[model samples]
Target: MNKKLSYNVAIVGATGAVGKQIIRLLEERDFPIQQLKLLASKRSKGTIVEFKGKDLVVEEATPESFEGVDIALFSAGGKTSRSLAKIAVAKGAIVIDNTNAFRMDEDVPLIVPEVNMEEAKNHKGVISNPNCSTIQMVTALKPLYDRYGIERIIVSTYQAVSGAGNQAINELIVQTKQILDGKEVTKEILPVSSLPKKHQIAFNAIPQIDVFEDNGFTLEEMKMVRETKKIFGDPSIQVTATCVRLPIIYGHSESVYVELKEEYDLKEVRELLMNAPGVVVIDDPANQEYPLATDSAGKLDVFVGRLRRDLDHPRALNMWIVSDNLLKGAAWNAVQIAEHLIRNDYNESK
Candidate 1:
C-alpha cells in the first residue's frame, strides 16, 4: 500500500475504558486521519462518542465494517476480535488488537512498541498488544535485557480494578461507599465475571485475575509468562507471575525480581533506566521518592523505582513497575503500534 496524505481509522469497542483513551490519545497526538469510525457491540450502537470536539456515533461492528478502513484498533473482548479481526484484515486494514485473541498466534505479532516495534513490520495483518500487566513489566525490563541478558524473572502484580472492565470499577466504588455507610456490600463482577463465584474488590486483594489453569497458574499469570518470552523473542528466559486484583482504580503495579546473566553496578543500572525511552525512573528512596499508583494514573510512560541489588544473588535486582492499566498498558500502546504502522507504511506485502 502506498502512503496516503491521511488514512481512515476505525476503533472497535469504542465505548470501552481503553477504547476511550485511544480516541483521546489519537486526537492529542494529532494523528493524521482523513476519517474516523467508531465500532462497538450492537447494544452500544447509536451511542455518541466525542472525538476531537466532534460527536461520532458508535456503529455495530460487522465483517463489512472494515470496508474502506486503513487501520483498525480493537479493544473489544477476545471473542469479538476473533470473529472480526480477520475480516478487517481481509478488507485491507491493519488490525492492532488489544486482546488475547491473537497474542499467542504464531501468525500474529505480539507488540510492545518500546520493546518490539520491529516485529510490526512482519505482521500478517494483525498485531496484538500485550496484557496490561505484561506491557509495563516488559517495557521496564527491555533496557536491562539488552545490556545484561535476563536469566529469570519473578513478578507479582497488583493490578487495578479497571483491568476487569467498567463494571468492576463500579463495584469497587459502590462497595467502598456501602462499607462506609455500614450497608451490605454487593458481591459481583470480580475475580472472574463469568464464573459463579464473585469477590468484593473494594479494600481487598484477590490472588487470581483470570481463571486458573491446570498447572495452578491463572490465565493472567500465564499470559505474562508466555508473552514476555514472545515479546523478547527469547523462550529460554524463565518467567513466573502471580497476578492479583487490587482496589486501585487505574494503575497496575508490579514487584519484579529479575536475575541477569551479568553482574552490574547499581548506579549504571539506574542510568540505563533513566535514559530508556518510554520509561521514567524515580528511585530516590532517601527523599521518599518512588513510583506510586496514584502518581502513575493517566500517565503513558511506565514508571520504575525501588531499584536495588537482590540480597541472595549478585546479578539479580528488584524493582517496582507502575503504569496506567488503561493507557500505556492498553490504549497508549495500541496507538503507538498504529503510529508505527503509519510511519513505516506497513503492509503484509512489506
Candidate 2:
C-alpha cells in the first residue's frame, strides 16, 4: 500500500470481523495513515486483507509490531488485549481496545467519546470502548441526562448473535435453515460458550448473556451497570439491567426505562434526542415510526424512539434504542476514540 501520512497505524486482530471493520472505516473516513500494519494471530498470519484497493498481508502480532506505531486498534478479544495492550502502550502506541479485559480497570477509561471524551484524554496507555449496548444507550441518554437530570435506568436488551462474534451469528442462521427443513438445530454458543448449557438462539430470546455473577446478574448486565456509572460519571445514578441475546445478526436493540430527577415533558425529550450527537430520535407512534434493529443495521447513529412516560412510574420514560452491534458498538466506537485522540492530541486535563 502507498504511504499517506506520518502516523503509523496498527490494527491488532486485523483478520477478525471488527478488526476488518476498523480498517474499512479508516479508509472510508480517509484517516491519514502513513503505515498500515495488519496484525493477527499466528494462525492468521499471511492472510491477505484488502485496504484502499490494495491487498495487504496480515502479520503475527507481537510487542514488536507496535514499535513506532502511533495508534493501535485492538479487537482480538479480552485475552489478546490483556496480553498485548500493555505492550503496545509500553511502545508508545495508543491502544484503543475493543474488549472487556480492561474495561473495569480503574486506570483504564471506559469511553463513549460523544458522551465523555474527557476520559479519553487521561489514558493510561489503554482506552476502553464501552459495551455496544451501553454505547447506544448512553449516547441517547446524555442530552436528557444533562437537561432533565436522570435518576435511574432500567434496560432490557434485544441484542444480536453477532455481538457474541461471527460464529454465533453463523450458528443462528444455520440452525434456522435446518429447523425450517425439519432438521435438528444444535446449541453450543449462546448465553455463554464456556457454560455447561447452551440454548437455541434462532427465533428465541435467551435471557442470559455472559456468565452470571454472585448477584445473579450476567457479566453483560454488570457491564451495563458499571459502565453506565463510569460513562455518566454519576455512580449515584441507579442502573438495573437484563441483557438478552436474540437471533438478529447485525444490530442490537434496547428497551430502556429511565426516571428523570425532574419531571420531563415527553416532547422536550424527543427534541433533545433529535439534536443529540450520534443519535436519531423517531417518535411518531401514529404512523408507527420507531427504532428497529433491521432499520438500524449498518447505520452509525443510535436510533431512539417509542418515547412516552412510564404508565406506573410517573417520573420515568420508556423508549427503544438500536444500532449496528459491530459498527457503533465495537469497531466504530474504537475508531471514534482514535479520531478523538488525533483531534485532541490526547490531552484531557487541559
Off by over 4 Å in 2: 1-5, 347-350
Model 1 TM? 0.99
Error of 2 at 41 (Å): 1.8
Could you give candidate 2's per-residue lDDT for residues 88-142 as a string of tens digits? 8888778889989999899888999888988777777888999888998999999
Compose the digit string of candidate 1's lDDT tens values, residues 1-350. 44888889999999988888999999999999999999999999999988889999999999989999998999989999999999998888889999999999998899998899988878888999999999999999999999999999999999999998888889999999999999999998998998999988888889999899999999999999999999999999999999999999989999999999999999999999999999999988899999999999989999999999999999999999999999999999999998888888767554
Off by over 4 Å in 1: 348-350
The total number of steric clashes, by the backbone 3 Å criterion, in model 1 comes to 0
Displacement of residue 2 (Cα, Å) in model 1 is: 3.2
Clashing pairs in 2: none
